[model samples]
Target: MRLAWRGPTMLVTDVRGELGRGVTSTGLWFRETRYLRTMRLLVNGRAPHLCALGGQDARTLDLVYVHPELEQFGGGGSGLARSEESLASDGLPHRSIDVRVSHAVQLDGLESRYVVANRSRRVARLVIDVALDCDWADIGDTIGDREAPVRIWARAVCDGSSLELRSTHPQLRYVTHVEAPGASAHQSGVRWTLELAPRDEVVLPLRVRAIDFEDALTGEGIAAREDALARWRASHVVVDTTGHGVEPLVIAAALEDLASLPLLEGRPREWLAPQAGLPIYPALFGRDALTTGWQASCVDGGAMLDAALARLGRLQCTRDDPRIDAQPGRIPQQVRRGPRARLGDGAFAVSYADVASPLMYVISLAQLFALRGDEALIRPHLDTARRILDWAHEQAQGGFLHYHTRSSDGPEHQGWKDSGGAMVHADGSSARSPIAACEIQGYWFAAQELLALVLWMLGRRGDARALWDSARDLKRRFHRAFWMEDESFYGLGIDREGRLLRSVTSNVGHCIASGIVAQPVIERVVERMFAPDLWSGWGFRTLSSAHPAYEPLSYHCGSVWSVESTTIALGLRRFGLDRRALQLADATLALASLYPGFRVPECVGGYAKDEMPHPGAYPRADLIQAWNVSAIPGLLHAMMGFFNVAPLDLLTIDPILPTCLDRVRVKGLRVGRGVIDLDVWRDRDGRSHFDVTRREGTLHVVRQPPPESISVGIAGRVRALVEGLLPS
Candidate 1:
């Protein structure tokens, strides 16, 4: 019963196709304010009998209701225009009528289309009453955690076929328009009457648009959004799975979700830079976009990813502003466009205090350049990347990077697991301010090492070596500062008092992905990763089950995040634990089968496999998260050992196919201007084989990693040709 549809900007109405019906998280919201709040459909003075709800597209919402006692109306009973079997409705078997409410959620507004069909042999008459209202409330208000500002109730003026709503308070003025054909607007709603011939249908449309709002801000200016679903299917990456049971469906679902995230209805089906997710986080998040883009780059996100990086470059902080924790050369955590953000009211208007964002941005640039090999794509952001490095170096104290926030609006914990008390010690003690998380150090190490490789390729040898030296030094100190010898794993982080927050969390797995985990400790880390307390069987839990503060449904304390699982799985693959990595993917995809649309949510319950009938839903999970969708491509790419370092005009594939996926053909995978179609399969003897079904460019396909081990000079690449399995 808790169904919803999402689009650019968006409508969050419930299954009743009405706002404020069963869930308070239902309304037409954009940025920080709810533009339209009240809407309900009535048949003959009372709500119709609800039957079913469905939609195939991400942006479309459909609800079918039955009007069991639809009676003939005369001139005195004028209203809107007008379903079922004997057991389907309360009416007789031959006297059933169906009313379907179809909604097209758009950037500037939403359009509700009512299609009333007479399924019975007799003619049908129905009176439809649509109540409309608007109340301005921030997202915090709907979240119901006492953080939201007061709601703004607008006055409505009704005219024939049109209703105008306007609200003005101390903070802002908001307005919206509602129009429908042949609708007689009353004090706050509209009424319609229709007579349909037997087996006939009538489509009555109602449109709502925000006054003076620009659709171009979030998506294309067009409101109809007719071709969105088609483009999601036929555009960019087309993955065909022959025998991979449900995972292929999950893969296709992920690709569709990624293509539709931006909600653009343009032809040629171009994918533009997108927001973080739907319902909430409808804006560019630095860590989310950078990380997601890094994974999506290997498949079909090259065009939009560079654009996102450029935008992040532009949004990079140029000077110190402690009020928002904006440091010179630091990228923001999230960028917002709502009026509250512009007017300095929203807590996350432009948060920049996150510790991992700058590092992820730099790493994304390195990974993207490796795939695209276009120097110009990253040239514009080099200075920003350098300054970010400088900021990281400046923040480094005693060879460890720490994050602290003094602003009231700034986040308490700066790592990805930033929920309150997420950085707790094993004894359930909170890690105090200026905390240095293990994952941050891993990202820091990767940022420096990868950027150095990029610089070395760009003719900045001396600069690259300095960074490499710094990275090598950090790796040595990292283990000393955070490793817990007894637990055979890295500690969670170090607090201001220099006490390691010794919690056996999943943060160490990220260190594996970054190539920072020591070889001596790799097996131990892997052992701890699969330890009963850490592996939930569905995926890796953020905090081990044995942790004192572990909560199955807690946002970051113990929930199984799809993105987190993908990262950990990739790390396992990098460490030559292919089976373990594929196991993680299989478990994740199996969990994906339980979710709606074959897509993973932001996070699920951290319960073990046998703990519940299904992984309990996290109370605040976003079903269409950007990073969650991007995980599909990352998981697939890892499965094939496909690494594209296009700077050398090379793509190395060392495949070890898992049994679950029998045959996978990837088309439209771009490396620079050329596209590739690759086929990967596993033989009955357990040997992996890949055939380049089609290639359309001057790309040299190899079965080895990029030649990044040029220890001496560019001319020495031949002598230093062999690259290890370790991630560059």
Candidate 2:
């Protein structure tokens, strides 16, 4: 009964083996804490504070500083370190608590009750605890001088009908006294009763504040240990019995227990191999070494994938706006709602960036759908996605796709890296619009090819071929017009003027990866991308090192980005440069570890490790960035050589596991036909082999090697039946 629904980019699981359902891992626990806003209590609390005293030196603690404004990731800190100034102003408002007593306790059977209420819709369990630092000693001063003295004191009074306060400690001596409400006021202990105005709404508030007490100084008032004791006394601890049923307290306790244990030995995710300089661990269950501390076995990888697919699917938008009262169709949206504004015509309309995003999502969804070959999923989104391609085609002009009329914002850099500073011309100046950048073109080609594949899989041969033909035409046009002869690379952009903006950059390589470039182009792009001048130990800079405008610290000018590097690695593999692709994958993983914390960063400084010695921070990097994490699993698939024969209930695994990875296992891998257990290992001879055991549904494995040159070893008698088949 375990069910998972995939959305356009998110996966929700009701299964008992993964993140939210039934699995738990220390690594996964960190996921919840990585994002500041994810925890409701952290953001909206009263008198909020970030506390950390255990482990690490105070200097290390001082490194954590907060910024004045909220960043995209919700963290607002300056530097990777902590600071007291930031800590003091760190959190939200607080609740106050006051104690009411009817009598000074001389009796043992006294009862006290507390009333509480929630003002916010978000649920939060209350926690109360009190502590007494009786022996307040400064180790620094004590080490060089005499011991510091301390004393304590207080007084209380209670009325029969009014609230009373009392000094809980006999050692407390009263320094100051305030008059009580009744004539029977002055006593070490007195009784009182209090009245509340709102009988149903009044609630108990927890308060932690400094209090004044008597100093036990002698008549001499000498400057000695006794003198210090006279001025300062014991600090009391107030324990609350309210902190029950909170998961954070429970989980924090568990983590504390684990932290006490000796460190466990494990493998890094990169042990399996690399994809575009990134590690290549299996999707669901990672390598034991790499996954040992991570939550790898929550749900079956198959079920998780299915869930992610479903969540991402729900977010998938299809169908652009028609002229007026148009029929709804299944094609992906040509223009989706973005930031709206009132037009001269007196109506709000969507912007072009918003419109183009739908196109990107459709392409992403279609690719994932084809890979999984889920007919039910495809049937729901297929036609609309195809229509998106058709619509986008109508917007094409001058051998390149232009921003549609829906793109009222025009083409002010409509790609994912849509920052105003992103686009540039050949001479390193910014480019004018009515232009299409190279990556968007790649995405268009990818979308068309994906739609064609879907159509072909669904028995629409003619339609599929026609779309593929269009893609081919675009591909040919792209190659001819965008190619830069002297630079031996493709231009980054081309405008309506037929002017070329050539830049030897990451975007040019993305074109190669999209399979839009003819073979000759891919070879040249790959050669330049991995060159010593452009390649840092961590990753390829956005702009190659040799470029005049290259600045290693620049965001788009020279920084190494995960999404771009991932596409480059994919491109290398697409061009049959497996070894080189693997090198990049491994390198990216190493670069990923360069992040002070092993968690992913959106992009890091493009400086070589030697130049910076540590990963440089991209200012305002989204800490728990989605695409960065996604690239990890995607890179693994690329290295593993896992792909689907859409429409057919078939899967092909041609594992090229690096020798570093002894063995990798994947359980519950869902294919079009059914679920299967896939095991891959690298033999001592440096060759890789795989044994895919079907667990559910029927699968006819094709034994023949695919036209591609990746290696795969098939097991079971079912292997030959598939190998003898055609079209593999």
Candidate 3:
């Protein structure tokens, strides 16, 4: 599916820019409801012949078509371009008439500008029909099993010039106004009849506006959406690929997706962070937002991460609610406000089942602070951070750092791998609740370790020491509890009764990303991660194929997630696993290239790379997810070995390029109080070189590797710290 979205509203359509009724996921949706479902454009009562369609960008689409009735082309299914194909299929071809449609998504509406030209030396008479319909089914109704309590069909009103379609649900009201200035309105659509002289063209513009009427459409940038898109593109670092194909596509797709993430209708404007993704997850998600912010931080300078933290801080749980797994200072898993969620009926309105969100929040905030060096941005969240730490301590007392579901309606598993059977044992049985997943523990350890540094810097030495104590204790315990000496990889998690899940998984490589794994086991963890059972060649599988519960198409059991591979790659790089990290990054990007528009889905089937030339589609996966979109820049950052410690006035850059990328130029890299532009390129002989073209900050740029304390032996780190080499 290709889409153009503005904030929470998105127009999902086929590659040809046509949206029709009963088409899979084709519609104009606002928030969680599908407003306009069908839009079929026809010329002279016949479908136009699509010449070319470009739907790569997220906010605009350009389609070129020829009047099928007026202009005929040869070949039924030739793989060659029609521009070069001989037009002698029936020899009944007349003058050529081309129709070019340009679609742009405004903040409050969608605009379709069509220009039809009579290129041949003959007069052309053409009739354009735009048949449209609106289905009031929400995302839940369209994508899930929940039936809308009250079905409301749209009532169309035509005034001979424009069409107004309105729907009134039991709990809400929706308005879709179509304005085609010179068109005549019909029963369910609009039409325009025109005659053009040879070499002349007519411009027809159709605008579709959807005002939900509940939360007023902000109308933000409706007048200047085109300019807004241009500015957004100019603001971020543009990666100019030097003689590369796949790398540029992946980076461009990811950046475009991120650029469309800023929300429009919901929260206060001050802390407006980007929503998760379009059509499905278009709301603020605790884990998704935090991770996305961090993942894209290498490119955006942690701007979104900081905003996400502030917004989540403002909406942090205030009191204990067992039904939603809420506790004071617990960051919510997802904040939803659809019709059903607003009524608290089906999906959770706001949940706290994500055991890793609070920890991720802390980590994100710390990373933000480290990048910006402006403590003021993160200092506001100190109290929330401390309270979250306290909550973590409280939950860890009896269970040894784990989580259990308190609400039957919430997710069974709370981590990234939250699928129902994600925590299954080797025997295919479900692991008991309060499971201490390795990634969760890793997040907790990393949070504690990072937050303590921030606290220490903020003059709260006592709390800092306490955080350090807990972090060290958790590390020791995690190593003793989760590590399997025989396999040399960490267990998935421990059951509530202290039994190991005994399933080889991707969490060990993931744990390395968290910097929680002791240095001594890095190689073993690496070895286990690359094993045939877990490494699916394209990426790391969530679960080992040897397990009885492993299914290539399953949500978490064996599906390979771009986000997971990104984390593993980052972790691999953190410990100087350059070759392995590049392998993972190359594999992930290669897999991404096989998908539509080079945008990775939420997850794909964990088939070996050799087994499938294309990515195995994960059923119902979010095609343009923020989680997977960030994987591009995240993996790039990992390969570059980019690290920022604003507090220390240090920015490290160690770039290692893969064979796929010949050269990459990054502009607009933000450091502490400064921005830098740099380039990393490989010579013709394949030797990589790094060059910083611009540096405008006091932040020291160092060409060095990651700190030894990251993956080196913990005992050695402690000894080095004692000897005053530097704090780990």
Clash totals for all candidate models: 9, 84, 1
Worst 10 residues of 2 by lDDT: 28-37
How much is the lDDT of residue 296 in candidate 3?
85
Write candidate 1's Cα lDDT for 1-728 as tens digits: 23333444577766666777757667777654677777888876767777777776766788988765435434465322322233224333323667898887665677789987888776566678888777766655566324235666677888889888877665566777789988788767888987777789988899987653433333443433435444434547778875547777888788777766653322322225566876667677788877777767666646556756777788889878888888888898887766566467537588797988899888888888888888987898789889999999898876889999867888899987777788999898888879888999999999999999999999999999999999998999998888888899999999999898989888788898888888678878888898889899988888989989899999878888888877887777666676687788788778888888877778889999987868877886775788888888888878777777788777777666666678888887777666778887778887677777788887766554223211134543332234322222
For residues 330-365, write the lDDT of model 2, one tens digit per residue. Answer: 211221111111112111222223234435545555
lDDT of each: 0.75, 0.42, 0.77
Candidate 3 clash figure, as a count: 1
Looking at model 1, how many pairs of residues clash?
9
Q: Sort by lDDT, best first: what order?
A: 3, 1, 2
Q: Which candidate is the best by lDDT?
A: 3
Candidate 2: residue 366 lDDT (0-100): 57
Tens-digit lDDT track of model 3 for 686-706: 656677788776756656666
Model 1 — which ten-residue stretch has the worst lDDT? Answer: 79-88
Query: Model 3 Cα RMSD, Å?
Result: 4.8
Model 2, residue 506: distance off in Å is: 0.9
